[model samples]
Target chain A: MSVLVYTENWNGKFKKLSFELASYASRLAEMLNMDPIAVSIGQVDRDELEKLAGYGIKKMIAIENDALKQFDTQTYTKVIADIASRESAKLLVLANNNAGKSLAPRLSVRLKAAVASGVGQLPEKLSPFVIKKRVFSGNALAGLELRTETKIITLAQNSFDLIEKPADMVIEKAEADLAGIAPKTSIKDVQIQTGKLLLSDAEIVVSGGRGMKSPDNWGPIEELAGLLNGATACSRPVSDEGWRPHEEHTGQTGKIIAPNLYFAIGISGATQHLAGISASKYIVAINNDKDAPIFEAAQYGIVGDATKVLPKLVEALRKAKSA
Target chain B: MNILVCISQVPDTTTKVKFTDNNTRLDTTGIQWVINPWDELSLTRALELKDDASSGVAKVSVALVGPVSTEPTIRKALAIGADDAYRVDTEALDAYQVAAQLAEVVKAGSFDIILCGIESSDYNGSNVGGMLAEFLNYPSVSGISNLDVKDGQVQVSREIDGGKEMIALPTPFVGIVQKGIAKEPRIAAMRGIMMARKKPIQIVESAPVEPLSQTLAFEPPQPRPACNFIDPDNPEQLITLLQNEAKVI
Candidate 1:
């Protein structure tokens, strides 16, 4: 039996998330005493496929088909399910991102496999296939056990570290039979957000809230984000007031992010807001109120006006980077 | 066209997460239950579509897999403008069981459009819609930010990594909606709240599907350490701490 990892690529290049999935699958494969195999469905080159070897993937299946270029959910599910059946994959792993979230559930139903989505850590035990995952919007955790023989797991991004265990890998080309299959949905148009860091993929996020007082006072927030090469975000109230786009809202009803460093400037962290950002590794809050709830969740805080502290902090960071 | 919006009742967003029964179950004492924020938005969008006479949406209904105790939450959905509601008579266990039970309801109703939240705030499973679609053998579009129906044709838009894709599909599809589906969830007025009492709520028997996964235990997140305060006078000290102590920058 083999542990199958789906390494999705963007325009023939693999992102850090793919390697993280491979690393997670490799570790799980070790625990199960199974081979770690990777499957790539897009037009990834051989060199790109070989990178999985560093994560202990011994074999890679590369499927390049014109019909599979645009990523139809149904077609991709069929292709992956076909591969799993052929390889006798006992466990399948995917990233808990947009694509993975779309694919894992359909695959679970198709394969009759038990699925545990948004799994945050490695299994606590392998005998009964016990794993832990975030629940209640990151406010709590739940330990779950899969009772089915075939299991599917979607790894939460940035929750697992990338560990390198080098192995000699072989890449094989395969063809998917798409004779009777047609995409159920048709893509009419595509619009790609350009020239700005996406909040969901950013490593650092600088977010503002109602305490900014007005949309006109957003200069320092943007400047700080530009300096850190991070993305800009806001609270739900700010978005509702039309101070920022709804896409920039990071809260329970908005986008949930897990950046490495989250700067909550001029924001009193409400529980709903904290639910979206609590997964952030380091939280820094700058608020005039010393007892703001954000400070409770923040690792470091400055009890001062954000307008006064932001420019000075930006200058200090500029000097530090230059030095 | 009939639209079915799947809703789940969860603890209010501000409720403190606590466990009971040796950490195996959620404590129910003094906890206020509400329709999940995402599902509320989905119901709002479904009602919006139905409200537009040109949209050709005839009715909006809601389905939930919960016990009789959750009827109040279902009534809340009805008050928000769902024409009717269906409650599968079972406590929601895992995503699979919920999806299976919901599939039975959908098969019986034969709704043209099905709407579901991307994830519930409580379990955050993010699974039911796709699994339900698979169980029904219907096409599904996940992460839908914009959904519209014109002359009985459905169009949806969803965000990809750095892009947005607009999709055109036939009816009898599942739409896993997210934040932008509605500007804000609609609030029920006094008249609507009163009328909701007269709306029909059909309780369907639970399906025989066994749950594939079981929750063994629950635990609150580790308490964060006390915040390290930096003097407001020396703004540079915060940067120093970020560089040397936290090392995030």
Candidate 2:
């Protein structure tokens, strides 16, 4: 009967996406004439869940289960599907994170509700079940309407800004009957990737191609990405040539990213590579070829050797930072 | 080893897409549909595993949960390399719905390994493989950059934040292949293309599954203004423009 947000916690503190989802669901609740309730799964004490009241959530549902300590897609999905149905939630909102992406689709099927992922904005009151999302890797926006009785939606990363606000809310702890799923997937070890920006999570990305010549010369790309607090990516040719890891390749066949700023270094601007990055908000291509297709897509094109242009750009940024 | 590779047809990348008369349907005016790119990678890897295995023989079968129009792509998958193929006749494009139907088929077939593209180029949801594995109570991994199957176990290397995590799962699992898993996939040869004609393709009616979301209309992305070209030889001018106009600097 209300809008519910599955809040996320890391090391006893709420993840940034949780506040973002609560802030987002608050707007949706206002549209549906219902309250937005924040649900915290696992061993979150009442005090910890209640502290989320500062994010404008009117109510909190805390489910305490030791099994929920680590994420098992099946157990999490079962709990969410049960809660959504039992809570009589009209709409379920989640951040399109590792957990949310894995859980939302299954919950949708179990609840017979429409599920939307990579959702951007809430629907205008025109229809309660309508939502807008980025399609074709942010190349287009689509308004999708779910005609079902219940709906589930996953918001894309960085699309909705987290609100800094406080709320007066109620906290309720309910340990529902176990979803009957013993975790089959075990984390042999949690290797936290450190010392670099995550390509998928980065807002600003600087990528190179064979134009960088070799991996040894990749210091500039890494340095620039570091300065911007971004990630370093590469084209398919670079990966195939063994200059960079295949995971760094981004294109139609590679990872499709839609960062706020995409800086291409030495890429020939082939359509295949551009397919992955066309979704970027602002694309700046540096290549010697003025006729490169990437230039056509670039908001601004620099027709120069990437090696030469890159250093100057990095130098300029370093000086700007110092100033 | 019985491997089931799921392929989905999606609009070709770079296709200028728009909404149909109603927004729910995609307008195919100038657009050409192709096998999902990630699925193509999955297909390529599946074909490789089939070739490498000596005893298990890696019986590779391609399956798609879509309408008859998707068969051309299924045939394309056959051309790439597959022993047999299956398609559940349905017009549903939702990934979760497709996953449910796939689970029903897999339950009947009892495939030892499942392969899918990490994500479709069109929807880019990247959740189907994980959802399907969860539905069947099987171990699943997504965004795998490289994979191999041996000793009735599967090893997957997927890209994480900085490096890669190499994990092992039992045979009854799903592996979603990402791009860069292989270099330029070889187009089907004439013999392969001719052989694809004979591969048995069983079309089963899709069972009903609840859809999680609906699409009202497709909105094209905001157009970028014409590119501002800088003189190639002039380094200072380019630097000035990048700092003042492009603002990346």
Candidate 3:
């Protein structure tokens, strides 16, 4: 028996989450004293798949099919369940990302395995298989127990570290019977966001809230982020008000980010907004109200209007860089 | 065209979360409940579609997987312009069971489209919509920001890893909606509130199923560290602190 990890890739390249899954699965395999196997779908460069070798993956299984170019939840779930059954995997791991969140529950239903999503930490106990996850929108943590023969866990995004434990990996290609696989959905077109740093890759993030007043006031915020080479984000209200794009929203109901440094301008730090950003290593807030809830969570606070403060801060950073 | 929006009641975002019953149950001593913000957006969009003369939407209904204690929440959804509401009387059902129950409701009704929040505020599982789609054998699209329907086909814009994708599906599909689906959540005016009191909230018995996962215990988050205030006049000092102390720049 082996532990299987479903490595997710996009555009013929593996995402950061693939390494994290491989790293965490390797650790889980060591605990269970079994070989860790990585399985992927669609077409990706074999050389790119080899990168998982450093994360303790002993075998990489690639199942390529022309029909599998795009991600289909039903097709992927059926294929994964078939492979897991064949290998007799006791534990399955995935990243709690957009794809994982949509696939895990359906996989559980098909495989009859107990599934847990948004798991924030390693399993607390092996025998009972208890995992800790954020609940109540990050206001509290819940310890969950899954009593099943096979357990599926989706790791929260940016929760674990990727350590290099190099291994000589063996790559295998399996020819599977993918007949009669009809997906209900079809892609009509795709438009990619261009010329901006992805939020997941940025070390620093510059964010604003409704305190910015209107969409017209976003010039300084964007300029500040441009100077720092950081991604731009906003609170839920800002997105709801149409002041910014929805993808830039970071909060409990939005994207969860774990940047090393986060700059909050004109934000009050509501519990929902704080839930998405609590993972940031350090937070700096620029709000006029000293008693704003953001100050309680921020490491550094500047009680001033962002309209006046952001321009000066940008200027200072520019001068520092040039000097 | 019949539209059904799945909504859940959650503790207000500002509530001080607490647990009781050996940390297995949420404390409800003084907690205030509201329609989950994500679902509020979905409901608003549903109402907008119903109001559009050319959208072909005939009625808007809401579904909830909760006990009778959530009737007030259902009434609030009706006040926000949903024509009817259905509640499955149950508590603490897992994601799988919740989806199954919702699938049963969908099967009982003639719905052309289904919508739900990307995930709930409490559990944040982000599973029910897709799972429901699987059970009903309907196409499911999660993280959809915009949706347009014409001639029994829907064209949607979905947020992906680093970009966006547009997909088209036939009628009777499930959409997990996010912020871009609606600009603002509609508020219940006095007339709508009065009308909601007379609206029907149909209570249905839930079919029981074993939960695959169970909550064992709970723990509050660690207290945040103290903050250090800086004068706004010295912007240069802020840069120095970020470079030397934070080491992030």
Interface RMSD of each: 1.9, 3.5, 2.6
- Per model, how many backbone clashes are there? 0, 10, 0
Of 1 and 2, the candidate ahead on lDDT is 1
Task: Please list the residue runs of candidate 1 whose C-alpha ends up more than 4 Å from where it truly belongs after superposition.
Answer: A319-323, B231-249
For each candidate in turn, the TM-score is 0.96, 0.86, 0.92
- When summed lDDT is taken over every stretch of 10 residues in candidate 1 chain A, the lowest stretch is A193-202
Q: How far is candidate 3 from the true structure (C-alpha RMSD, Å)?
A: 2.7
Per-model chain B TM-scores are: 0.94, 0.88, 0.90
Instruction: Give the DockQ (C-alpha) for candidate 1.
Output: 0.70
- By DockQ, rank the candidates, best first: 1, 3, 2
The top-ranked prediction according to TM-score is 1
Better of 1 and 3 by TM-score: 1
- TM-score, chain A only, candidate 2, equals 0.85
Cα lDDT, model 2, residue A78? 77
True lDDT of residue A95, candidate 1: 86
Docking quality category of candidate 1 according to DockQ thresholds: medium
- Every model's Cα RMSD, please? 1.8, 3.9, 2.7
